[model samples]
Target: MLALLLAALQAAAPSPGPAPSPQSPSQIAAEAPAAEWVDITPNDLLVMELAPAATGRPRRIVIQLVPPPFSAPWVANIRTLARARWWDGTSVNRVQDNYVAQWGDATEAKPLPDGLLTGTEAGYTTQLDQQDSVVAGHVEHTLTPPITALRRADGGLEVDPYARGGVGFVGGFPVGNEGYGSPDTWPLHCYGAVGVGRNLSPDTGYGAELYAVIGHAPRHLDRNIAVVGRVIEGIEHLSSLPRGTGALGFYERPEERVAIRSIRLGSDLPAADRPRLQYLAEGGATMTRFIAARQNREPPFFIRPAGGADICNVPVPVRAAP
Candidate 1:
């Protein structure tokens, strides 16, 4: 996993927070979870169990998610599980220069056994039709000061402004949640981000096979599909794979393509089999230092300071289970 994340490594540029638009009664009530969400807001550090069953007592991991806006926040004691069953037959579909790395079974392959979304909701299918869709439509628009400020095409993720797939950021993960109203949220080709290769049809992602972004953040693929997970560690393994010569970056030689041994959810594994992981809740000293360090470039390589920082440039560090 670490190898893949390093290679693939890789959003919510929405309206400014602090003053939520007066939500309707239902909307207000629906926000209870967001409110009760254990306050994972940026800057705050909360410890989450890497694997609830990994140990007799939950093995702890420590890391901070750069508060609100930065993608790829700091991580510690986190392990990427072996790749899981994704759109099985899908192959890497498209790869553009300094843009994105996409994959799917464009050959019109069928989903491998035991790897398809069973229903419209639940499981990793995480339908955007919930309280907060993956990419909220309003947030996509309403580019205001300090909000929606990420460098993106005029239209948001609904349609690829670059006329590719889509591009944008959702939370810390760079994605283009296009067609978000009807709620079309799929993974885009963001560094370290993952996507199930598919064909022209949207529903092609049966979650049997998947791919990780090997290059630049492909903003054009935003909101185009569902992005279930990301490279928490070892990103380089997938990213460094030799470029494929087939239709969509497919390896010209079979040996060139990295082989997938197997994939299973950490939760599904036995106590002994599970990998440890911890997602640092946002808002904490870790982030404070990170943000400041990023803004000023104080590490002292050259002595030039950025004066300001964009959400994309910062990365949340991931490490071993503490």
Candidate 2:
């Protein structure tokens, strides 16, 4: 009887399959069907033109603002700033190595540009309050299984990477949300993320000063600062700037700052000049495969895959629209 039972157990065991082939993230993205890509709307684009230094070539940086239902207030403020040309004369005042490159009225004394709606600052505070209330109300709310299940279904495993609950994307921007079910989500401070700079008071920042993450992802700043957008193109213009010699990456001398010629909404520009961009759609089969590829590095560069990917590490791919 014991011999028969042992033989039956051995027979019941499943046969192992061949090891899965390794794929680079680029390959996975390239293999994604065209239907999985989404075009970036002009309304969501901020085209910033910087005054040329001795280089004589004005740098054009394109930033994609987050859509509504997340960071709406701050987004509104940024749009207002752009529309009012608030950043037209502002300059890049700080460039910290492996940190952020900040730009705005370094003096912080410039009056809010004309045409900005009255009580804009108050509106920002109110919106933040509303967002916080919503988050608080849903703190205990839970539903659905974690993203691990989805990852598993896609032949991948969750390594619990990133400091946030579950990292994903909303409207093309990488977002950190409360696991599988909750609505609590915030834009992550990944490399090239553009955030509003503030003072000691959280509500003080009214979208005047903005900074881009130039180094490692500062996950600690997530949800703490108002991250309104991400640099979709020309990040090298800011990232490759000279590092500041002053404290906190501030240029010690005003002469060292880089000037901004103008910051315009892409929609405000002529159709011929508007940037045509497309980003890989999130929450699709292609995105899943891309994330998996990132999590599992292939053999040439990595013998042992980390089997995990941080939200910041997996930047959503963007390119000029073909």
Candidate 3:
């Protein structure tokens, strides 16, 4: 009876399976079906043309604005600025090493152009004044609460391997969570993230001056500043610029700054002039596969896969629209 039981137990044991085939993030993305891709609309696109300086190559940077419920005030302000051509004459004034590359009217003397709608600077106003404005026939921009973190089955919040807090995505933007099911959600300060510059006051930034994270992800700034959008294309143009010499990476001389030729809303451009871009749908099957592949690298080059991935480490792939 003992011998028979041993034989049955051995038979019940599963056989070792073949190792998972090595798959890179690019390979996984390429294999994704067409339905897994999302097209970017013209209304959400910002096309920025930079004049060529010593580099001899003109730079064109494309930014995709976030949808409503997050940073609505700042997004509206940026659109207003673009329509007024407020950034046309502005320059890339700051490039801090291992930090951000900022561009705008560095002198801080440019007047708010005419035809801008009200409530754009509501962030800088007193709470009582803001309430009064809303009550007194002023149209208020509605901001949606974002889903920033996720709760686990055990009633604890999930934490990524990098320990940067629980992270997720909303409308394709990476978001960090305060806690599982928390009402507050803020965009992550990942690479290529575009943020508004402000003074000491939290609401002082009016989208006139903007900066892009060109170095390591600064998660601390996630909720402190308004993250309007991200650089979808030509990030190299901004990231490769020379580091500024002045305090906080401001250019020491006016000539050191790169001039902005123009910034136009993609919707305003002709069909042929509009930028074509598509991104992998977040939380979809394709994205899941890509994330898994990145987490556990099976390639021979990697002797041991980390078996995990950071929020910033997993870059959402983007490509020209077909």
Please tell me which predicted candidate would have the highest lDDT against the true structure.
Answer: 3
Give the 10-residue window scoring lowest on summed lDDT in candidate 2. Answer: 134-143
Tell me the tens digit of each residue's lDDT in model 3 across 1-322.
9999999999999987898777789998998888777777787888999997475877899998865556777889899999888998889999999999999997889997765433333332112111121110111222223332233334444465333446666566776654443444566789999999887753447788899999999877766678888999999999999999999999999999999999999988889999977878765788877877766777678898776666777777888888
TM-scores, all models, native as reference: 0.49, 0.79, 0.80
Q: Give the per-residue lDDT digits (tens) of candidate 1, residues 213-274.
A: 55766554544543444565555434443465666565565434333323334444466644
- Note the Cα lDDT for every prediction shown: 0.37, 0.73, 0.74
User: RMSD of each candidate?
Assistant: 18.2, 8.5, 7.6
How far residue 293's Cα lies from its native spot in candidate 2, in Å, is: 1.2
lDDT of 2 by residue, 59-112 (tens): 999999875555666777788888888888889999999999999998888889
Instruction: Rank by lDDT, highest first.
Output: 3, 2, 1
Q: Backbone clashes in each candidate structure, one number apiece? A: 91, 0, 1
| Residue 36 lDDT in candidate 2 | 74
- Model 2 alpha-carbon drift over 4 Å, by segment: 1-23, 114-164, 179-182
